[model samples]
Target: MVMWWLSSQPKGQRQVVVSILPSFICWHIWKARNKAVWEGISLSSGDICHGIIQDVVLAVSSEVNRWNLLPFFDQFFDRLSEPPMPLQCKIVRWRAAGTRIATLNTDGCSKGNPRASGGGGVLRDSEGRFLIGYSVCLGVSTSLLAEVLALLAGLRFCHQRGFTQVRVQSDSLVLVGILQCWFQCSWQIRREVFHIWQLAEDSGHFSHCFRETNTVADILANEGLLHPLVQMKIYNHPCMLPQLARGALRLDRSGFPSLQLLKRTPA
Candidate 1:
């Protein structure tokens, strides 16, 4: 109504009327809601919906009238009635020549100086099929150092397997940022991590994943402590290491890695 009124007046009157009208309506509604709430008056869902529709209609109508597009309101209403379909997410695969690329996920864990740590890597083809998994123990080290080592080992494994283009994934945000050149590492592990960065750069592509999305690598890392130096191979199936022996691997009171060798051999 304000916009229609402004359209009848001079062009200079449109902006002032449109701006003040919405502010006035918003203030009025806000004051009304507060008064009702303070007076112990409950608002129904219908009332809320009515208020929302009123606000939207007021804004849109004001803009349309100010622009003298009242005649197009019918077209806008028709379009709004049948909204466009949402876009679908499509997965794009990267292939070179005739071979598809590979994606690798790696993670590291330390239990106790060097800390008793383990690193894991999983290789998958472009079709998301598992190729192989690699996990190794780090005798002692910081978590960041373990992360760097894990990535380096993963990339090296991929390179050795003739993976020309590889996508690496990790749950370590710090390690991923450092590898992607998005964050700078402190002098503590800068020199040692440089080699890891170089390995990632040499690889085709890499990605950072949250821990939820990186459960495979996370499980492998923790399992590495149980089956240190043990490699299990499954034919035509995803391989998984058995659970860690109970009361075998213990963390020190200080929360460091403690090695208590169990009496079990890999079959």
Candidate 2:
């Protein structure tokens, strides 16, 4: 019956709904059973369905923009009582590190979540002179894991090369939050995060930057996808990077600005 119902869903929604429906139903059912057994409170069928909807909403809310692109989710959101949110544009620029300190920027890319992932990082002195850069091909990994591994590699390199008092930056807000203990660490990347903390504990300072500011690192991360599996390459000069990446590095050193338009979230 469940399979038949799932198959009956609209073609565009069948895959998405099928992926989540079983887990949602099973989880809610288990919770309801526990509640009834322990507290002697029974949930009606409508109540159980409501709980599932709420769970689904919460699960996908973080990536609302992406989900809203899908026809099914777009219509689902349109039916909500809340008004559609407006968009906001803001200026973003790359800023140099403080005098006498080195800045390390890192980024990760995945063709698809858990597919063809890679990590990369670049270190530069206060004057924006590139000191070192590295790219790693991470096989069959999630973007979050790639980000964590990239950060760990950068921190480890700094520690080994005696680059104390370094400024660590990445475009991944969740990664920066994890390093600062502002967000809960997921089990998947907890171990790598531990290693990152160990290397950066005393000498490193962490910050989250916009993608515009971390262009070089982002480029390097994408380039890693073409590298051999489990391979890591180090570059000491801008010329060692791809042509476009070299241009981005030159602009970054010359204080060029990149603009990013972001939507304002409702308070």
Candidate 3:
């Protein structure tokens, strides 16, 4: 029934709904099923539908523009149509590390949680010169897993290259907090993060930066999705060089993504 409703929307809106709605809806259904089986709890049809609608609205709000989604939002809330919220602008240009410490920026991408995903990282010297970088395709995984994977890849690369002094930067504040001893993580996260902290702990620092400041690494993550690596295959991946060259990946005069440069590219 929801699938039929999705098909009735304009192509642009339909695509957005298709990409986000199915997994979100299915996941909730699955969770509800699990509760029914394990905990003997049941939710009414109305309750489930309302929950799904809320989830869809929040998830799409981030990626879709406000004006483009006004009608869709109206459909959900009906007679009490909520005003579209203004977009928030918080990201700043990527900054360099101090002195001789190299800064590594990392990010993750996923089509869906437990779906096609990948991780990427960019290494730069304190002088802000781009050095080696990496992007790996993980066939399936949650985004948090992908986030940890990207951090692991970057930290391992630095360790192998004998980078004695380094600093790690990420847009995910949760990941940063875990590294900074602020919060405990899942056992899986605990294990992977231990290795990274060891690698960078001696002469390193972990910090949280806005996503706008992590542009180089963000492109690297998108590159991973665009061209997933296969085992035994040596890809002459540009490290997303083509995007950087064509202004598709976009960087400022200092070769970092800036607020002024973060326009939404049309599909």
TM-score of each: 0.48, 0.65, 0.59
In model 2, residue pairs whose N, Cα or C atoms come closer than 3 Å (at least 3 residues apart or on different chains), thus clashing, are none
For each candidate, the alpha-carbon lDDT, in order, equals: 0.58, 0.79, 0.68
| Off by more than 4 A, model 3 | 1-91, 202-204, 229-240, 245-257, 260-267
Per-residue lDDT tens digits for candidate 3, residues 30-80, read 888888999999977666677777777666665344433333444653412
Query: Candidate 3, TM-score vs. the true structure?
Result: 0.59
- For candidate 2, write residues 39-109 as lDDT tens digits: 99999887887777666666656445534333343355444434446666767767765788889999988
Q: With candidate 3 superimposed using the best TM-score fit, by how many Å does residue 69's alpha carbon deviate from the native?
A: 13
Root-mean-square deviation (CA) per prediction: 17.9, 11.8, 11.4
Stretches of candidate 1 off by over 4 Å are 1-99, 112-114, 202-204, 228-237, 240-267
Q: lDDT at 178 for candidate 2?
A: 86
Task: Count clashes in each candidate, considering only residues at least 3 apart in sequence or on different chains.
Answer: 8, 0, 0
**Pairs with steric clashes in candidate 1:** 111-257, 112-115, 112-256, 112-257, 114-140, 114-141, 115-140, 115-141
Q: Any residue pairs clashing in model 3, and if so which? A: none
TM-score of 2: 0.65
By lDDT, the candidates rank as 2, 3, 1
